[model samples]
Each structure stands twice: as C-alpha cells, then as structure tokens.
Target: MKSNINVVFFLFIWGFLLACTKAADPGSTVIIDPVVDVDYSDTSLRLQDVAPFPIGASVSFNHLSNDPKLAAILYANFNELVFNSELKHGALVKADGSFDFTTADAFVDLAKDMDIYGHVLAWHRHQGTSYLNTLVGNLEQQELLLDPGFEKSTTVGSPYWFVLNSGDPKGTATIAVTTQTDEVKSGTSALKVVNPTAYGTADWRVQVASNNFQTVPGQKYVIRYTAKSLSGSGIIMVSAQAMDGSGVTHYPGGDKTITGEWQTITLSFTPTKENYRIVFNMGKKADTYLVDDVSVYSEVAAPDYAAIYTRLDEALHTFIGTTVGRYKDRIRKWEVVNEMFTDAGEIRSNANSPAPIVDGQKEYGYFIWSEFLKRDYGYLAFRYAEEADPTAELYINDYGLEYSDKKIDSLIAYVNEIRKRGAKVDGIGTQMHIDIHLSQAKIDKMFQKLASTGLKVRVSELDIRITNSSTPMPPTEALLEKQKEQYQRVVASYMKFVPPAQRAGIAVWGVLDQYNWQYNGGSDYPNLFSTEYKKKPAYGGFLMGLSEK
Candidate 1:
C-alpha cells in the first residue's frame, strides 16, 4: 500500500515538471555569437620609428615597381634607400660607354620623401668593362701558330706541326723534311712535298695540313708563307678546317698557283669560329711544292696607356660629377669610393690586381681604376663628389673590416692620407656582412676603432650568413635565434661604442631574408622579414636593440 502511494506521487511530480518546461521547440530561434576583441598593435611597428638614426634598406628597383607588398614594407620601415644596382657603372653605362640614366632616374622617383644614398662613385667591379677596354685597346693578337717557321723540329712531328696527308694514290707523293738553302725559306727547316700524279680538281686528294692553332672569332687573321713549285706555276690549293671535328672548311684564298721562284703567299681571312687547321692541296698540277716561313698574324691595336688614362680620367669626371649633380637636390650622402683596399690591407693596383693589361687579350670583368690613376683614383672620386654637391656627406666604404685588423687599420690610414691630399672623406662604412657566430669581441673591437676615428660610422650591408655549406638546408629555430641575437648584438654594440652624433645609421642589406642577395640555393636567415614578407623574430630582436619594447 505504501509503495503504490509513493509511485503515484513520483509520477504526478514528473508529469508536472514536463508540463512546466516544454523542450524549447527545436531550432525555432538562433542565438548570435558574441564579438571578440583582439590586439594587433605590434603589427603596426615600423623600424624607422624606433631607430635613433635613419634605417636604410638596400632595395631593388624592380621589386618596388612589381611587388606591392615589398614596396609597402620598404615605405613603412626604411627612411633612406640604397639602390641595389641601378646606379652601378655597368647598369648606368651602356656598352658604348655612354650614360643611360633612364632606370636610375626612375628609381629615385620612387623615393617619395625618403632620402637617397648615392651608392658608389668608383668601383673596379660592376664597371663598363668593354668600354674601359676600348679606351685602352687590346694589344695585337700576336702569333697564334706555335712553330710559325717550322723551327721547332727539322722533321714532321705531332707536338708542333703535323703533316695530315701523304697523297691520293696512297704513295704517289712524298712529304720530305729538308733544311736545304734552295728549299728552306726564312727558318733553317722547311716542308718539301713531291707529287707525281695529278688528281685535278680533287684538292683534298694531296693534302698536308698543319697542326691546329686556336682562332678567335671575327679576328682578322693573316697567314703569310713562302712557297715555290718545281713544275712552273702549279696550282696548290690551301683550305682551313676546324680541328674541333666540326667539318667546317674555310677556303678564303685556297686555290692559287705557286711560281717556280719562292714567293710570299699572303692569305687574309677573319675566322667565323675557333680552332683551325691550315690545309695545303698540291695534287691539282702534279707539282713539287716547297713551303716555308709560315706565319699567322692578327692585326689588333696595341694598348696606348696615355690615351687610356686621358679617356678614363675624362670619363670618371663625367660619370661621377654628372650623376651626383643631377641628384644633388634629393641625395645629400654619397659613397664616394668603394672597395679601394684589398683584404690584405694593401691598396689595389695593377701590381696587386689580376686584370692588368693582358698581353694579347682584353679583360672584360674587372678594371682596376687605380691601375692608371694610382692612389689618386679615390682622391679623384672624392674630389668629383665634392664638386657635384659641396654639402654632401661623402663616405669611403669597404668590406671585411670586422675581422681584419690590418684591413681596418689600412682603411683608417688611407682615409687620413687622402684627407691630407685634399679628399674630403666625411665618413667610413664597414659592411658588416657577418655570420651569426662572429665573435662579439671582434665586433666590439671594430666598433671601438671606428669610434676612435671621430667620423660618422655606418653598418652598411648588414646580413648574417647562417651556414657555411653551399648546399641548401632547412632552417631551424636555433639558427634563427642565433641570427636574431647577432642582429641585436650588432645594433647594441653600435649604440654602446659609437657616439650618438657619429652614428650614420645601420642599413639592413635586404628587407627579407629570402630576398637576400646571397640566398640563391640555400635558406638564409639574415634580414628582419621572412620570405613570405612576414615579420621575423629578428625584426623584434632588432626593435629591442633599438630600445623599443
């Protein structure tokens, strides 16, 4: 009776609760999601704002025009722009040795309110090499034939000259080596060929080809030799074949008759290719041919130093003065002379240079400006920059100074020496293209020495080389941390050692690590931005170093 009563009471209570709550009609009304607050104040950070001095970036002109994101980062961060290459000699000067500043002028136009830093006035590399070479002129293409007069050997041999063929009938003709006064020409020895059978019009039938000699393209070569025929006035065909197995034949003055008396045969032809073998075909008239005094010459002008010096001196004045004068209104700072000293602490000249005026060739890669102008090259560059803009802050810049005590000392000394000579060098830039693990002690020491000079000091071309391996590798957080630390340490050291007034500024070589000039194959972590244009840890680290939170 008690259980029945309890059950009835529970049922009644459950029914009453269900009646009171009617399960909110499924999906009848929807609830809205609440708006959340987020912070992105850090993303708005600009490097130029925190840095004490101008934060510069060596920027590419094409990227500014093509990549909007890259341009945004550039405009947002950097206050000064260093043209990656537009102002370079090779870029501005055409092959004809004339200035074409269309691209350079357009590059300056992108610097809206930003200062322009004239990269260089004089440099051996990135120069108009062909034009400079033309100024000096290449020496005559001297003798190409090893043994011009067949003087190397009295008999036919392989090393110097080789007689390729005997005759058409297999043994109808004999190639005899003789030093007889009647047979030989200028040299003591000569090649005497006796052909008894006439394989008329079959020029290659009785052939004696000389050993191959290297030929230059478009080089007008003159082959001069003395020849005589025993049978009066017999046709001896001379043809040239490429020794490189190209099967290409050059028959400029091939088919000609040799008189009974020894006569000089001059054959002139500009080669279309390289590696040529001279061929003599004497089977046309069944004659005994005596050939001697073979000489191959190319009429190339000798280098005239006086003329070269004059042309280049005038060219230097024009390149520097004209470029700076045009941009004087916008650019007030200039790197007057770059890389004037070798890593060995010695001044670079022809004696220390590899591209000295070569004997029979032209150097198109490097032109040592000091080879002609001597130490006065830098002096002249400074003079030219001063002449262009009297108020411009002129700097002499170089690399490898952080590690090389001798190099730093040499640069300082040279600057002092040049200043005495009336070259107004206003600053010195140490391109701190260092690695992450580069000794802090070395960096401090370098800063100390630079600070001692009392000239404006700049860390130009700042980038950290993560790895020494040429092969590409995946980047690691540890490596990145080290790069960040390096970037921070370098900045802090500049502030610690260099006086505030003398800090010309620290210019990160590139805005992004992957955009790094050195980052071709492998991953490089050198800049403040990642390859995706995202801010890197190095960016915060650099900001921290600038005394920013």
Candidate 2:
C-alpha cells in the first residue's frame, strides 16, 4: 500500500471565469474554487484507509520496529497489528512463571499510534509447559481417599463414603450430600454431617467413614480438606483408623474445631498398617458440618493434580491479568483463550513433547490449560481480562472454523456457554488460514454461523495459500489469481454476512510470502505482499472486497 501511495496524487486545477466578461458586472470579478481530485482507483488506494472496519496485518515486532521499510508499509496501511509469535505465551511467559514484556512493551508503544490486539491469554500449545507440568508434579503419590468429597453420594447416601453408625446416642445423627453454594468449599458438592448427640458416652453414635483403602507401611499420606458448620461453633474429630482386628486408630492431624467460617485441615502421617479408613467422628459434635475438596494422597512427587491446579490457576491469572493490565488502556481487543478444541471440536487432550526442551517449552509439548482447569477456566480467564481492562473487547480465537463443522460449532457453543458463565466474550475470531482451493460454500457457512451469534465477528488471520498440488512456487499466475479471488471472497463474505455493528475487522496473516509461516524458509507464499514487500494482485482484490456493498 505504501509503495503506490505516491500514485494517488491530487489534481489541483484553477478555473478562471472568462465567460463572466460577456455578462459583465465590471470590477466585481467572478472567482471559482480550485478543483481537487483524489484518485480512489485500485492502483493507489490503501486497504486500511479504504476498509470500513479496521484492517490488520500480522508482523514480527523486530521487523516492525527495526526494518523501516516494512514498518512504513504497515503504518501506511494497517490500523491494527498482530505479532507473529512475540505476544504468545511461550514467547512472553517463562518456565518459572515470570514474564519478559520488554518487547511487548515496545509493541504497546507502537499501539499508541495504531492498534494492537492481544493474541492469546490461554492456549494448549506455545505454553509455559515446564512451569505448568512442574506444578502438576509427578505421579509418585497415589490418592487413597474413596469419595473423599462424597461425590459418589446420591440424595440418599454415598456408596464409598457411607454412614457407619447413627442415632446410637440420645441425639439424632445422619450424613447427606450437600450441593449448597455456601456449603461447598471447593468443588460443586460437599459432604454434610450432623450429629445431634455429643458422643462422650460412646463415640460410635454417628461415624461416617470412607471405604477402607490399602496402604503401604512407611508410606506418608496427606489429607487436605475444608470443614465448616452452620452455626458459629462446633467440635469435630477426624481420625485414621486401622480396619485390622487390633482396631487401633490414629489422629493424623489431630482433632479439629469446626466454625461458622470455613477452616482448612491437613492431616499427614505415615501408615504402619496394610489397610485403613478415614473416619469423620462427627458424633462428638451436635452441629452440622460441611466438608469439601477432601483429597488424600501419599507423598509428594514432582507433579500433583491438586498442586498443578493451584499453580496453573495462579499462572493463568497472572498471565491474563498482568499482561492485559500492562496495556489496559492501549489494546482494544484480546483473545482470552485460543484454539481450545481439536479439529473434531473435542476438548484437546493432554500431551508432552516428542522433542527435548528449548528455552522454556518443547516444540511439541502441550499444556492443555482446559484439561487442567476445565471449562470454567475460560470464565476465570475472561474475568481476569475483564478486571484488568474493562474497555477491551475480549475474544476466544480458533482455527479450522471455515473447514471443520465440529470445530466451528463447538467453538461457538463454547463461546456461548462461557458467556453465560459470566465471561464477557465480546467477540469470536475465526482464523481463516486456507489454501486457494478452499470451498466458497464452507466460507459462507462459517461466516453465516458466526454472524448469527450476534457477537463481533473477526477474520482474525486471513491468508490464502497456493499448495504444491495446485501450482508451483513463484506461484503461477492462475493460482495467484485464485489467491486474489480467495482474498476478495473472504473480506466480502465477512462484510456481507456480519452486520456493521458486529464487524470487528479482518487481519492478513503476515506481510510477505516468505515469512508467511505456512512454509517458513520454504516455498509457501500465502500473503498479500511478495517477499520484496511489493503489493500483489491479491491486495487489489482484497481492496475491492472491502469496497463491497
């Protein structure tokens, strides 16, 4: 766009009223305004200036900041910028959960003049894999608690965590599963125990114990849980009891005092028996107690599920909040989550590297945040972004939306679901990275589905590749023409289907073919510009699409 900016010259013509002499009002000379003409012709127009919605292009911050010519082209045309990899998790976040925002800070400075959209706050790949995996420490310890939180409990009773004895004393005693919001300390439900009788006469009045679990002698085990009572005060006793004939019992963390306020309890001890059960001696108290997130594991290894959850949750918060907050006033849009689903639209699976580590993460390693935090993590991440920058338009971007029905639908469904869960997902970004041969029908359907959602729709990454099967590199003219038409169709479809109120904008994937990332250092040519930074035929076609009615 900048290369030809000079061709869009203005024509200034001075018109003299020579005919005024014939009609004549003597010294009162008739004057005419200079004729100014601006050529809106294809050869001279700029995509960013011509498009109704903002036009964006992905570029390397290094090239954008260091290479003046490339930077000039971007500044001359694009209004919004997407960094190729600098803004991603692996690029900014360290293995130790620290951030290096120096480059991103400079990008924010550039955003002062233009716009910079947040690439991602959470994703499966390009992650702080080491830090995340480290948090989910090793598999050295196995959980030994059966239905610890009473999740197996039906309305009637729990199968694994069952009532051993009740109503043995003067007072009534029973155990039930509670799903009340206030009663649940961690997960969706908690175990509710009420003992109306103080078990001073016989502690067996009400005994709710977990099914006995096998234990190894000399193995250390820890149980962590939160307990609270309806009233302001109560006393409860927890014990680890041997199921053997000896009937010996041990209080790992000793007895506990339950209160109106929830209190966390951690019981750690080494087992000296073959099998034992965790007992809630609530018969000692006459008040109702709620317990949740009761996890019992033996020993700490490199990674633990509970530990991983805590660390990753914190990391997710830090990554979203700190990064978004730093540029709260600068950026207008952010991808709170990206590519969370597979091509088949299922939640992505957990995976580790096939390659060794470099920097912080391995090339093939994946830390599926969704796998660890679950779907609710989306809401949490969105909330963090919202809190950091209330004005930013938050989005969750994904690829294959145009080609895969499952991918597209599931993404839309997930977006809607999270929105209902209080995530302010202002938009959904479809990364349309395709080949010139992509079906127009799929494009139409994809756009139609996105527009119907009424959320801001963005062509987050637009690039039409010319595969080797279709054409050879130094791409044949015919394929280039298809590329041109493909570009036009994308922008035109976006405009035609998405209402003006919902148009977030369209962003070309990259500036030049060589750096297109499709076949980096290879034959891939998937951008609007040639390697020389010269605008190609697709640029004009894209402009035409933006000019569409």
Best candidate according to TM-score: 1
* TM-score on alpha carbons, each prediction: 0.70, 0.62
Write down the lDDT that model 1 would get.
0.80
Clashing pairs in 2: 136-303, 136-304, 137-302, 137-303, 137-304, 138-302, 138-303
* Highest lDDT scorer: 1
Q: Stretches of candidate 1 above 4 Å error?
A: 1-44, 139-302, 355-365
- Give the Cα error of residue 144 in candidate 1, in Å: 7.2
Per-residue lDDT over 65-121 for candidate 1, one digit per residue giving the tens place of the 0 to 100 score? 888999889888888899888898888887787889999899999988788888877
- What Cα-based lDDT does every candidate model obtain? 0.80, 0.76
Show the lowest summed lDDT stretch of 10 residues, model 2. Answer: 6-15
